[model samples]
Target: MHPENTNFIYVNREMRTLSNIDYDITLLDWLRTNLKLKGTKEGCAEGDCGACSVLVHDGSNSEVRPINSCLVRVGQVVGKGVITVEGIGNEKKPHPLQTSFIKENASQCGYCTPGFIISGISLLNSNKDVDENSINDSVSGNLCRCTGYSPIVKALKSVGNNHEEIKPIQFVEQNNDVQLGLVSYHNPINLDELLNLTNKPNFRYLAGGTDLNLQRPIINEDQNTIINLSNIKELKNIEVQNNKLLLGSAVTIENFLVTIKDRIPELIELLQRFGSPQIRNQGTIGGNLCTSSPIGDIAPVFLALNAKLNIFGSNGRKKVNLNEFYTGYRKNILTKDEIVSSIEVPLPKKDYNLFCWKLSKRYDQDISTISLTVYIKIRDQIIDDIHLAAGGIAETPKYLDNLCKDMKGQKLDKSISLAINNIKNYIKPISDIRGTADYRIESFRGLFRRLEKCLVDGVKTMSIMDYNNE
Candidate 1:
C-alpha cells in the first residue's frame, strides 16, 4: 500500500516556500482547514465543480492552467507552485478581473466567484484580448446555481475592455522545515531519474490527474505508488519538425489549443467542445489518449490523422501508431512500467480534405453518442486514398479498413454507397443513455452523406468559428 504520510511544499506570496505537517490530507482540505484560504470554496469534493479551481504552473513555467484543488493530493505539490484565489490580490489592491466582477454584479451567492475570477484571470494572462466566446468557454466548468451567467460574462468583458496590465506573480520558495502529514515527494527534474523511478512495479504515472483524482482515496490506500509527471519539464514541450507536430505528455488541452490554433484552426472548434473550461485547462492529451475511452474526442482525430505515440520505460523507448495503441475496451497496449512520453501527428497534404463531427446530447460538456473522423485524398474526381474512424460504435475507436479498401480509386458516388453499406455491416454499437442503437447507426449514415456532400460541393464544413460560438 502507498505510504500514509507524504510531504507538502507550498510557495508563498513573497516567493518563500514552506513545508506543511501531515501529508495524508488533500490539497483542498489543507487549504481550507490549515491554511484558512476560504476564498477557494469546495462545491464538490470531486473535480467536476469549478468552485475549487486554482492556477498551477507546470515545471516549464511557460503558462499556467487552472486545476481543481479538491482532487489533488497535498503530496503532489512539492517543488511546484500553486496560485489560489488568495494569491490573486490582497485587500489593499484587487486584480482587475476581481474589480470588474464586483462592478458588474457578477457575484450572486458569492460561493463560486473566487473560482470564476481565478479562471478569468488565467484566461486574461493567456490572451490579453478576450472575446465573448473565449469568456464563455473559460467559465463553462464553473456552476452557479443562481445561473447568473450574463453578469459574469459582462464582468469578464469589462476587464477585457479596460486592458489593464497585470504583472506575473512568482511563487515562494519551497520550505523543507515544516512537514505536512507525510513526507512530500519532490518531482524529479531529470528525465532519466523520472524514467528510472517510474519503472518500479507499483508506481502510477500521473499527468493532469483528471481521472486519477476521482479515485484518489483508493489509489492512496491501494498498492499503487504515485509518480506525478506534471512537474517534469521535459514532458511539457511542443515542437514542429519535418511536417509533424510533437506534443509532450504534460501539455494540457488549453496549451494544445493555443499551439495549433494558427496552423489547424478546425481543431480549435473541436477542442472547445471537449469539456468545460476547467477540464480543458487541467486535462492533458496524453492522459486523454491513455484512458482509451471509445468516445474520447481526441481518439478518432488522432486515428484519422495517423498520429504516433512515443513511450518510455526501463526497457527503453518505442514508437507506435495511435490507432494501434488500444487493444480492447478500457485497455491499452502499454505495460505496467511504461508511460507515454509524447504524441506526433503528421501534417495533412495541401489537397487532403479532413472532417470531424460528434453527436452528443448537449453541445458542450457531453460525451459523444457517436463521433466520426474522415480524411480523404482526391485526384481529378477519383478517390486516391481514404481514412475513416469512429467512436461510440464499437468497443474501441475503429478504422474502416475494409471500407477503405473497397472505396480506394472508386468515384465519390460509388465510395459513398460502399462506405454507408460497410458502416451498417461493421459497426456494432450498444444502446446507451446518449443514443439508441438504431439512432447511432442512422446517424453514422447521415454523417457519411454529409461528408460526401461537402467533398462534392468543394466546401469545408468544419470551422474553429463554429466551436467558438458553441
Candidate 2:
C-alpha cells in the first residue's frame, strides 16, 4: 500500500476516495464486500452471467453504459461514475423500469432481475426508440436459470417506449494527471508516467480487464503490481492521419465502432457479435489484439486490411504489421517491456470489396467457431489486389497471401476457383469444442463459393445481419 497516494472513484452520488487500495480486486467483490451493495448479485464470477451488471460513465462522454462488474478491476473506474441497482431506484421511489418489470411479471427466481433491470435502464438512457433486435442484444450477456425471456423482453420494450428520461448522476472531477509514484497500484494519466512504469520487474499492464479478470491468479493476481492503461491520454485517441486511420490500442470496442462505423460498416456488424453490449463496453481493441486469441474477432479483419500496430517501450516506439505481430497461439512478438501504443489501418480505396463472416453456436455473446475476412480491389472485373485472413483455424490468425497471389490477375470467376482449391494450403483447422476439423474446412470452402456468387451478383459487402434479414 502506498500511503502517499490517494485514489478516488465515484459510486452513485458519492465520491469514494481511499489511500493504498488494492488495484487488482474485482469491482464486483468490492461492491458486494466493501460497500455492501447487495442489490448487484454475483452469479458467475466470469463475465458470462450479467448479474453484476452496472452503469459506468467516464469523463470522455459521460454516457452511462452497462458492464459486468465481476470482470472489471476497481482501479479501472477510479475517476468514473458507477451506478448499481440500488442507485437505480429505491423502495420509496421506484424507477419506471422497475415498475414495468413488476407489471409485466419479468422476475422469476429473481436472481437475475437486478442485472436485467440495469440493462433495461441503461438501454433507455441511451436509446429512446430501441427495436426488437436492440432489446435482444442489450440483455444477451445475462443468463436466466428460469429461462423466462418473453416477459423480460416485454418489460424492456415497455420501458424503452414509455419511460421518461431520468438524468444520470453527474460525475465529479478528479485530478488524474498526477505524476508517477512507486505504488503497488498505478493509475497513470499521461504517456510519460505510463512509459516509466513499463519496464519494471513483474509490472503488469491492464486495459479493460474483461479478459484478464477471467484468468484470475494467472494474469492479475492479488499481489502483483498493476498499472491501469485505460486513462492514459495518449492511448485514448482516434484520428485519421496521412491517409490512414490511427486508432489508439486502448480505445473501447464500442468507441472504436462509433469512430469508424461509417468507414467500415461490414466490419462493425461482425464486431457486434464479439460479445454483448456489456462486454464491448469494458473491452478494448488493444486488449483484444494483445490477448492473441486464435478466435479473436478483430484480428482477422485487421490482418486482411493490412493494419499495423505501434508499440512503445522504454527505449522508443516501433510499428509492425498485424500479420507479423503474432508468433503463435496466445503469443506475440512483444517483449516484456513493450506495450502496444496504437493501431494504424491504411484506408481502403473506394472500389475495394470487403467481407467478413463469423460462425458460432449462438448468435450473440459467443466465441467464433470459424471467422474469415476477405479484402479485394478490382478494376474492370479483374482482381487488382486481394487479401484473406482466417481465425479459429490455426494457432494464430494468418493471412492467405499465397492464396491471394494465386488469385491475382484472374477474373472474378477464375479467382473463385483458384481460392477454393488453394484454401487448404493456408489453414489446418483442428478439432475443438466448437466444431470438427472437417466441418471448419468445409465451411471455408462453402464461404468461398458463396463469396464468388455474391461477387458475380455485384454485392459490395456481406454482413450476418443482412444475411439473416434476407
Candidate 3:
C-alpha cells in the first residue's frame, strides 16, 4: 500500500475514492469499481478501444475534450472534472447524441453504443459543421463486431444536421473542493511551479495520458510520482510568433487542428489519422514525441516541417530539432526530470511544397505500415532544397539526409529516381505484420514517382479515392 497525505484528493462525489493507491489502476477501473459507472465498457485494456471514452475538463475556460479512460491513471483525474456516459444524461432524458442513436437504430448488441454516442457528442459539440468523413474518422477507434456502422453514421450526421443549437450539459463546478489521491503530485497553474516540480527524482510527467498511462505501470513503481502538467496554463497555448507556430504541450490534437487546418491542410489530414476522436482529443503533441514509436503518425510530419521542441527541466529551457530528438527505436534524448513544454513549427514559404502519406492496410485506426513525408523547394526547374523522412522503415523516424543530398541540385525526374534508388540502399527496413521490407521499399519508390509528378505538373491534388472506399 502507498502512503496518503496532502497529495491524494478525497473524492466527494457519489463514488468512493481510494487513498494512497498502489498498483497503477486506470481511470476506467476507478469509474467502474469505485464510482459504479459501469456504462463505460472496457472493450480493450489498451488505449486503442474507445469503449471507455470520457470527457475530461480542466475546470478552465477551455472546451472539454474526450479521453480514453482505460489508459488514464485513476490519480490523473484529481483536480479535473471527469464526465462519464452516466453523467451525460439519465433514463428520463437522453443526451442528443444518445437520442439520435436510438432513433436511427445505431445500437446493435449495444456494446459499443455508449462509446459511439460519447464520441459523436464530443465531435458535434466541438464543431457543429462536422462533415460525414470527419464523423467517420472521429469514431474510427470504436469497433462494433455486429457491424452496425451505417446507423451509427446516420445518427451522428443527424445530430450535426438537425441539432444546431443544442446546449452542452453543465456539471457542477468543484474547483474549490478539488481532491487528489497522491501527495507528491503537482498540478501547477503556472510555468514556474511546473518547472520546480521537475527538480525531483522519479517524476513522471503527464499531459494527455494517451501514451504515458499504458507504459506507466511497468516503469518505476517505488519513487514513481507523476507530475500532472495538464493544468499548466502556459503549456496549453497556441500562438504564431514571427514566422513560426508554437504549440503548447497540453494543446490537444483536436484544438491544434482548428488552429492550423487552413494554413497546413496536409497536417490536418495527418492529425485526423493520428488516432480516434477520443485519442486525438486527449493525446498531446509532447506525448506523441515522447512515445518515440517509429511508426508514430505525427513524427514524420514534424520532420518534414522542420519543427523544433522546447524542453524544460530544473536546469532551465532548451531547444532540440525534431529530427534529432529521436535517438533510436522507442528511444529519446529526454531526461527523467525534463518535460517537453512546447513545439515550434515554421510557416512554409510560398515556394515550399509539402506532402505526407501513411501507407497502412486499413485507412482508419491502423498503425502506419510505412509513412513518408517530403518537403521540397524548386528553383529554375532544379531541386533547390529537399527534406525527406520515413517512418516504419528504420528503428527511428530518420531523415533521409544522405539520400536528399544525393538528389539535390538535380532535375526532378532523374533526381527523384536516384533518390528512390538511394532510399532502397540506405534504409534497412524490417519485415513486420503490416508489410515486408521489399514491399515498403517499393512503396517508397512509387510514392516518390507520384510526388515527382505532382511537383512537375504544379498541381497540389490529392486522390479523394485514397481516403474513400467507394
**Best by the lDDT measure:** 2
lDDT, candidate 1, 335-442, per-residue tens = 887888999988776788878788787777778898988888988878998888888988888887777788889998888898787777778899988889999989
Clashes of each: 24, 0, 8
Q: Could you arrange the candidates by TM-score from highest to lowest?
A: 2, 3, 1
TM-score of each: 0.88, 0.91, 0.88
C-alpha RMSD for every candidate: 4.2, 3.3, 4.0
The best candidate in terms of TM-score = 2
TM-score of predicted structure 3: 0.88
User: What order do candidates take by lDDT, descending?
Assistant: 2, 1, 3
| Model 3 / residue 374 / CA error / Å | 0.8
